[model samples]
Target: MASKGKISIIGSGLIGRNWAMLFASVGYNISLFDIDESRIDDALVDIKQQLNSLESKNLLRGSLNAEQQFSLIDKCISMEECLRNSIYCQECVFEKLELKVQVFQQIDKYVDDKTVLASSTSCLLPSSFSANLNHKSQVIVAHPVNPAYYIPLVELVPAPWTDEKVVARTRELMTEIGQKSVTLKKEIEGFLVNRVQYSILNECYRLIAGDYVSVEDIDSVMCDGLGLRYAFMGPWETAHLNANGMKEYFEKYSKGIYDVSKTFGEIPKMEGATADHIANELTSRIPLEKLNERRKWREERLIAITQLKKTLDKH
Candidate 1:
């Protein structure tokens, strides 16, 4: 197959590897780079294993098979080599402000005017790192959820100076790669996903701190109850469907919701005895040694869900 284009993936971590796979699935020639050269080789090995495993499960994406997709990625020793002639550069470095800014500055020096510079940050705002770059207009955040291959939502956040055309093009590219995307109108501290996540987390922490619910039970509330509906539709859609529509739903439940909201209390600090207790409870169930095993278990389910969604959409 002819290549779609070149895509540069900076950092050889899980996110960067996943991004490479996502792009390579669509036949994009991927340049994978890392500051530590050894990690690049390790990433390639891991990527091969993952692609082959996905193929065995009949979960591999796009028209290409595992071998073909794997062949599309090339390891690059230097940032300049990775960004050379690439249409998009995705930075997947660690989430420190200074580190992200430094990486962006380095990338800015190598990137051309046309390449879309995207960061894989979950919480950091785009402007915080891109403000001083010459190619700030090209910088945007394309934050993907964990296990990005299965969870297709990619948040597209643009800095204040980001070009309108850049956002449009990035959205188009995301669509081409079979990922769902939501664009932010303006920059926010945590962006959409993390903000909503932290809100839920705050309540969960508060409940545990107040001895209202056990950690395991709180998780069950999500996995067994809310997650069932959330897998198919969002909260707004759930409310809309539960009642006649959104208007009727709000009208009937508004007072009760308000009463509950009033009692939610202030955000609890995610530390101290409560944090330790939660950790101990969770570790007892899954254990630190089995975390990777559990992660694999999670990914398998995500893949199954992705396939199920595709099959359902067909009907």
Candidate 2:
């Protein structure tokens, strides 16, 4: 018999499988549910292959071997069975507001008062799709970064009616599964990560639109410069450590920052010729046909960096 504290992951796509594997790594029974049986079957196969690959690379989480962790995941044929006695249900449906509404509504019908109903939405706010649910207090968004197997950051944003305990439990569970989780004080569209990400992207777009930089050079600025320091620390820490301290740092560069900030002006529209030029330049370096292959290559570097961080922290 499976544990009543099982984690139910709805949808067997990349996000869903990643969630299932993360929970299973720490001995949680994972019930994977999907509308398409064939997709579910494919997810299971992909998951096993991923686990084996992680094991060979000495990257598998927890004390358990790949087989032991893989054994903890089960494919569920029905939503009712999947939700039955589950302590948490993470909905990983396609990104559509209407689809999220339908999924949360149906899930609300089958969950207990204690079950945490969370969404894997990247952009939608909780109230947008879950306001009318019977278990509104239990609904929240636990958005994970893509390539979750390599990245550990997850943002937990709660609805206005969400119970405080729900936020606490979600954070605790994420921590237990080796993920770095942050909970928002309230819901916000796109949450925290994407907001900062877009701020950077907006600047990149402006640079390209004004012919100040090429697409490739902008990427190099991130990959070879900002990202190098950002891997281990954030902007705040970077500033604090760069000078004597925060106060001295501000005194020294505050005017320079203000002057540079003025030039940013308004965000670029990024339509028509600007968009076409950027797209063409990117496609030249990484053709659309080889996106998946590139993603794998990117994840491999991320994994190596993750390992390096772990080793450095021990000293």
TM-score, each model?
0.97, 0.96
Q: What RMSD does each model have against the real structure?
A: 1.2, 1.5
C-alpha lDDT values of all predictions: 0.94, 0.93
User: Runs in model 1 with CA error above 4 Å?
Assistant: none
Listed per model in order, the count of residue pairs whose N, CA or C atoms clash below 3 Å is 0, 0
- Candidate 2: list runs displaced more than 4 Å: 1-4
The 10-residue segment of model 2 with minimum total lDDT is 1-10
Top-scoring candidate (lDDT): 1
**For candidate 2, what is the TM-score?**
0.96
Residues 105-176, candidate 2, lDDT per residue (tens digit)? 889989999999999999999999988988999998999998887899999999999999999999999999
